[model samples]
Target: MAVDDSSTDPDGGSESESSASGPSRSPSDSVSAVARSVADPILEIRDTTVAFNMDRGESRVLDDVTLDIERKEIIGIVGESGSGKSMFASALLDAVVEPGVLTGDITYHPTPDESIDLLNLSKRELRDLRWEEISMVFQGAMSSWNPTMTIRGHFEETLDAHDADYVAGMERAHELLSDLYLDPERVLSSYPHELSGGMKQRALIALSMVLEPRVLVMDEPTAALDLLMQRSILKLLKEVQSKYEITMVFITHDLPLVAELADRLAVMYAFQFAEVGPTETILRDAAHPYTRSLLNATPNLDADVDEMKPIPGSSPDPVNAPVGCSYHPRCPLATEQCVEQDPPFFDAGPNHQTACFHWEEAAEEIPFSLPEQTDREASR
Candidate 1:
């Protein structure tokens, strides 16, 4: 609700009508149009996998990881911690490290004919893209800010990287803070510790905009803040997305934020996407066992005391994956087939996809089953 109203930019009018020039498609159809417009693709990931080959053994951190980000859309990636939530974010920037062998396709298209495999890019290449084409606002965003650096300088560094105009950068940064309900002058002068948790998070967001990256990956950007701050940040993000016309990939376990802010969502489990779809459709009618568990796990503020639902069992261990459907061990509707065969993503509904053997049959049963509180704790 906040996102829709807050975005004021020409492109940010929530779900602005798709142009007739592009086949008269609606905003909902933007994903396909975006993919088509690019000569190759803006951000493409297909059947990508990442493995961690530690001394003990080779552990697949991500299996068949894939997703695409288009221009001017916000896609939310949701999952519990250790579900490889943050790892997926790092992998997008080709930041996964030694002992971590990446075998995935992460390509970014700056021009219709220019595409670079982000996974294989050198440090200099990545440096060029940083803050310009694909920037990140990391988790613990507040602490990431230098306690010694003034907020203005931190914001300036991003602009300075690309030799953007210094005076214009400060002016735009001030406007951003004001749009987010932050005091421009105060925030500009404040250090990390001097600002409130929410302010710091928003400042980090403002910093990411200096170079106007085509896509911005935000991992739990407001995890440590309060509900008010969370909503404020979500609103600010919507506004920023509109004003800057940047495609966003929002990572979090916060269903409320997904419901409130994201147009589309990608569900992650054990380092891969279990499901992804339009936000409302995914939340109200999840088709993945992990996703259902996450929804059922979300504590409903409107529910009666006795009606709260949570998932059962712990998340599967990524290091030692279970045989067959990784979620079978914890899935309520898992069958023998589920145990022997891993589920690949299939069409669950219009614009919805899932990787579960019994999604169709089990969808009806999951909503009624109350679960153990810790099963899929969406812990930030």
Candidate 2:
């Protein structure tokens, strides 16, 4: 499917103005670019849950989560730490650790007639699917790389594992790094320890895209970079997504940071999605109390420093989660109903859903403030 390349950068720059040249089609493009007569959504996640058995008991890290990721769109998953954001990404790739049991359907649509349930796939099948079809840029790029190996060796190893042409893969890696505004030759020759933090992060992204996967899941890709470097990385990610027409699931705890890049936002609280909607709609009119609290807690540059309110209480223990809504303990608009029953997703607006019983009263209960003008402008 063809995607529009007219997306503007979050920094008020035009995507077409980048100096980097566009990449040519990979050698395996013919095999990966199968016809899609299926629906618009590329991934269908239904009633998915991940639980780990420990000495205490079974702790549910991910609740019954259901989400549809559209093709060629950037969807941001935001939440506080331990909200199961990273676990969700891990589950997508079937990378859950031992003693953790994953349930429910995670269907991947690669072609018109093919529908593969990720949970049901064999180990070998899952291995074949990863990297070639869905690639991940894990958190902490420095630790992810080998200190002994040069950047070129990393690319060669990845290509070798996939049985791809080593020479062609290296050439593509050079182009990818160049597109990221990096010195390709120097980066390729240098070791991970030799490059700066920002450089390593960008190089990691370049490596993830080397195989040209259909979906790219990034977990805190800019966690270690400075503000300026973060901005640059976000811009480069946008450019890469637009150029390759690949769908991205960007996971982060910083709502403001994701606000600058995501097309749609999914706010997670207590191992479940509190709200999911278009970026502009969620920013302007959040329905769930947890979502509202998150917005209130976020420090807006345009807003007063005193106005930044933190969410009361911490996330619940996964092993001893509340009976009803896990967020009810922290939610301001939470009532007896909220404490007694788990609320299903209610329609907040067109294509906007929130899992809050007091969806109507959440806004009135707590003041909802918009983000900075620049963020809103960028999202629009």
Candidate 3:
């Protein structure tokens, strides 16, 4: 059967992994390449839900999350801890462990029109697409390397898998490591345990780029690094983005960093997206209460802030999440409607969407303020 991978309906039906045959270039692939029109979405996800089956029961990790990532643009997925950030990335990469069920649409655009439903591909086809078409640099990913293997051996394995020349791959690795300001010789010769945390992390980034995939998904790539190292890593990422022209999906809990680097921001809460829009729009006038809370919680250097306001209340457990809005319990402006019914993502502004019933009101309100922290505690 002929599968047109280059085309997809925005309102497409769910595709099961078993339904697809071996992957082949779609008919529209050439046509889209010739067009080369304005910026087009490279990846589009709609109603993606991921669930994990445990000894107790089934726990929904991600709930009906939808997002669109454009070509060569950086999309930041920001959220608190245990808010399904990593799980969301895992879903896109089909890296979710067994006993985990993924549902809904996840489309990957290799070219302008060439769209491959990631969830629809067979295991073999999906394996071929990963790293070759898309790559991921995971958090605490340094441990992923074989402790017994030399860094050079790791690169050899990666290049050999994709059927690329080991010599050329080593040369490419040297260039990337040098660009990232690392001593390529020492890095390649050293094992994972020998290098510093930051070095290991940067090595992972270089390794992921061996194939020069169009899309690079970084799951909190700098979380383990200190502030200075984090800045350095972020700078390197920006350079990589410009030089390779790769679209990136950076997942992190650091709202400030996201605002600084991301072209667009998607705020995730509980198991769903609370808001998604341009960085400026979200920073200047956030529409969702949760988005506002996140902004408020983040300390602003420009303003004379006395204290670091923390968002009150802990996030609900995914296994038994609240009925309507998962954030209703924590949302300051949550109403009866919020508790009873899930709010649809409403258009707040140009390219801005928020899943809050009182979005308009929240948009108009000033950023919230919290009780000040004491000097004794601040000293720490």
TM-score of every candidate = 0.83, 0.88, 0.84
- Residue lDDT tens for model 3, 131-230: 8899999877978899999998989899988888778888999999988889999999998999999999998999999887899999888888898888
* Candidate with best TM-score: 2
Q: Any idea what lDDT model 3 has? A: 0.74
Candidate 1 lDDT by residue in tens digits, 1-380: 00000000011012222344421212222233223322234677665666765555566666656566665778887877666777777777877666566665778877657788887777887887876788998877778788788988887777777788999888888887887788989989988898878878887787787666788998888889988888767867888788877888888888766667787777776666677667766766787777877776777665565665566677665556677877777788888988887665555555555666677766777774332332123321
lDDT of 2 by residue, 1-380 (tens): 00000010111101111123421112111111111111367887777788877667777788777777778989999988888888889888988776677787788988636788888888888887889899998877567798889998999999998889888888889889999999999999999989999999999999998987899999899998899999888988989899999999999999989888998888887778877777887888887788888888888878898998998898777787787777888877777887888776655655566666677777789886774475537545
Following a full C-alpha superposition, what root-mean-square deviation does model 3 have from the true structure? 10.8
Order by lDDT, highest first = 2, 3, 1
In TM-score terms, candidate 1 sits at: 0.83
Candidate no. 3 TM-score = 0.84
TM-score ranking from best to worst?
A: 2, 3, 1
How close to the true structure is residue 96 of candidate 2, measured as C-alpha lDDT? 77
- Model 1 deviation from native, Cα RMSD in Å: 9.1
Q: Lowest lDDT 10-mer window, candidate 3?
A: 1-10
Between candidates 2 and 3, the lDDT winner: 2
Q: List residue ranges in candidate 2 displaced over 4 A.
A: 1-39
CA RMSD of each candidate after superposition: 9.1, 10.9, 10.8
Compare candidates 1 and 2 on TM-score and give the better one: 2
